[model samples]
Target: MMKRFKTAAALMTAGAMVLSMAACGSSSKPAETAQTTEAAASSAAETGKAEATEAKKEDGAKFKIGVLQLVQHPALDKANEGFVKALDDAGLSYEIDQQNASGDQSACQTIASGLVANQNDLILAIATPAAQAVAGQTSDIPILVTAVTDPEDAGLVEDNKKPGTNVSGTSDLTPVKEQIDLLRRVLPEAKTVGVMYSSAESNSVLQAALAKEACEANGLTYLDVTVSNSNEISDVVNSLVGKVDAIYCPTDNMIAAGMATVSMVANENRIPVICGEEGMVDAGGLATYGIDYYQLGYMTGKQAVEILRDGKNVSEMPIGYLDQEKCALKVNEETAKSLGLDPAAVK
Candidate 1:
């Protein structure tokens, strides 16, 4: 195999020397021609060996990856974990720098700037805001996002099918209609639902709109309550207590961070909360037909591998989505019993 890559110059020179020796007379200086051909082959072999060693070193170089997480909630945390695990599982050499914004937009900006300045080979943004923050910094570096509902809606990309920029990854868009149906299955008589989320989250707003359309299609009245921050979650849940039969919370980072408060308030009123993801359900919401964040992140990590390892262009990479088969019903049995509903019956 290595001989095949021998230099054209050496091969041509060796051929020319043999032809010259044959023309001069078969027995004239045969040993000299043979020595000349052998020297050319040895030179070519050395060149090939050097080139192969250089390529091997380049292939073994460690990649620098930066992680910019929007917040430290379970969904985002799982997503972060999944992304790292994928790289490890692929047996790729990498040096990852993980940074959390602590749910602060300002912090997101700061961290994103630092990640870009560090000149990482790739950057993984865990949510919409973090994606936006990192994308705002550079157009050349590949960025993979997870736990984001709609990349185009968030202005991180021009199209979902073709990102047309240095941004692309898996979408955490859960089944809104199915989640609403889950609520209906659990509370057949429920006529109204309070759709709650953080006003600052673009992903939440997109899901909220889908939830509204689903609610109308199901013949249920929908009320929307928006909070600017996590501190207002308890108050917002309180405001929905008398106004709606149930509360529907999307996979909003802010809202998920305060799920315990939302649960404490909504469960007290015997109003079940249908969430957009499993983590929220575990945090005390009643149920959800939601996508797995870890799986979503793992999917995103695969995209990163394609970009970093396989040299796939991020701009041409279509946005990835988790199929419905990966989504399932998650119900908190304790919360169900507390709400006077059978845990198994809700299913």
Candidate 2:
């Protein structure tokens, strides 16, 4: 069945969104949803009903958007919430088909293709993997991404200016050097930092390189550890426990989802874990010099409205950045105390 938002249509407005959604859990829905919806939509589009459905949008119907999130985690979830709140505040009535890939690459492919099959006006892909999956399925559909660290490095665009395709959105590339500086200030005696992330995510790889550079500049040894998926997080983190002074994780989706696992193992060994975003800090990270994901998502939501309502070309939209990066130190008081750091003074 087709999911439609039936309401009076008005131009989507660009507004500041304050509501941040709760962290998400992976969707247990079958991966066939995309295939099933695609087949159904193909049949409808063939029978002229699809055009009729689109005509409804011209007659006071809601705008439809399909959101494909890579996994259930705080950063991604906050971004999703901000996007929805942006739409609501713009007074543009809309319906969103939100799907989570459960940190599975194949699941991302299935969800992205399905959203394309359903023929949503625009597709919102959170995370690099989600964006890549949808971009692979169609270059014609406008895809707006958020929580992605580096779009150009991930091969999502030609460059920030003039994406050269039907894709563009916000980049959550916080300053790695500042995050490392935060670690040095807090753990002044630490000599080696362990950097962990998903091996498969290009964004994580990019951030990890910057992290290594930051560590070098601080005269700290960099220990690298990576995993292909969440199943390896605890064991991998455990292996690196005594060998490093601290752990640094970028905005890697896999690590973000299993951060509690990373935190549990690392904290048990009394090592401080520094993260790339506030959501990670909230999860179990000792601290982070990170960005507010809610604001990032709101920015992506504004891009969505611009493409759908203002008739702007997404390919030329110029990859968006926080006009002023909202990066700052956020510490988990409990985690800090566990590591013997003065939580209040650290802040």
Candidate 3:
């Protein structure tokens, strides 16, 4: 009986040892599982934080704009100023990368290509050739043109009402027909009108054609004196000084640049001169019936605001014209007097 008791006691002790070992193994398994879960949670949290940081950086990014000007002139300078001011008023910050082509078409293309390669958000082309260069570079990037006489004639778009492409802006065109009438009103006895322009300028070509037609309608004779560069302006003006009753100067950039020379010659010869813009009149022209450049620039700024803030597509926005409030008839008193005329009569 004693031997049997001893064997039973031994069996009980073995059973207790087995239960203790099993409990230890179970506790160790739970610790290992907790460590694995913690590692996975830490990895997920780090990935989420990285994604949030990337999103914030994207939201805070500023827009970049590229400005390409054909040449630096007073009229174009005003337009550029207006554009920058309008963007500033909209409360949107931007970086303006301005480039001048120096009146070279190839230089314009190069500037445009560089702007495109940098991925500018928008492009403001200041003239016809600059606009054409941008259009040739990209169809996806939005382009806005200023100081362009006829967008259709420049081939920037098919129509002014509906650009039908990724291009639209303000036209610097004034009423050529009305300007002709004003010349007649100011100088009734003047029978022949001489038009001087740069032959290479598309705007000049278009304006000269319109002037010819208007002169024909008014029973006035028209003469065209074309100069290929600034060097020839003086000779051209001298050539036409005595031939015509009065000289008409359009908003030709080359002619506008050399206004002092043209004015000095015209003023000396006692030949009256009519111009297409106010700046020219201020320079030495007898009178001009056209839009105010500052006002036009301001108008262009407002259009840019619509494009940037209102999320309006540039292609859908028709080219805008300055209101009559922006148009005026300005005359140079000194120039009129030199021609033995009265400014009060036209005013």
TM of each candidate vs. truth: 0.83, 0.83, 0.79
Q: Alpha carbon lDDT of residue 229, candidate 1?
A: 82
Overall local distance difference test of candidate 2: 0.85
Candidate 1 residue 332 Cα shift, in angstroms, is 0.4
Return the number of clashes found in candidate 3. Answer: 0
Ranking by lDDT: 1, 2, 3
Local accuracy of candidate 2 as per-residue lDDT tens digits, 186-264: 8899999999988899999999999999999999999889998688888898899779989999999999999889899
Sliding window of 10 residues with minimal summed lDDT for model 1: 48-57
- The positional error of residue 18 in candidate 2, measured at the CA in angstroms, is 77
Error of 1 at 218 (Å): 0.9
Model 1 per-residue lDDT tens digits across residues 111-214: 99999999787899998999999999998678999988999999999999999999999899889998898888789999999999888899999999999999
Find the 10 residues in a row with the least total lDDT in model 3. Answer: 49-58
lDDT by residue (tens digit), candidate 3, 1-347:
99999999999999999999999889998889999999888888646634543453357546668999888777777888888887777776567898999777789999999999987767899877788899999886778888888888888887999998889998888777878888998889999999888888787899989988999999999888888877887888888767999888888877877788888888889878888888788888888888766666667767766765455678888987776545789899988888888879966
**What is the TM-score of candidate 1?**
0.83
Query: Candidate 1: misplaced stretches above 4 Å?
Result: 1-59
* Superposition error at 70 for model 2 (Å): 0.4
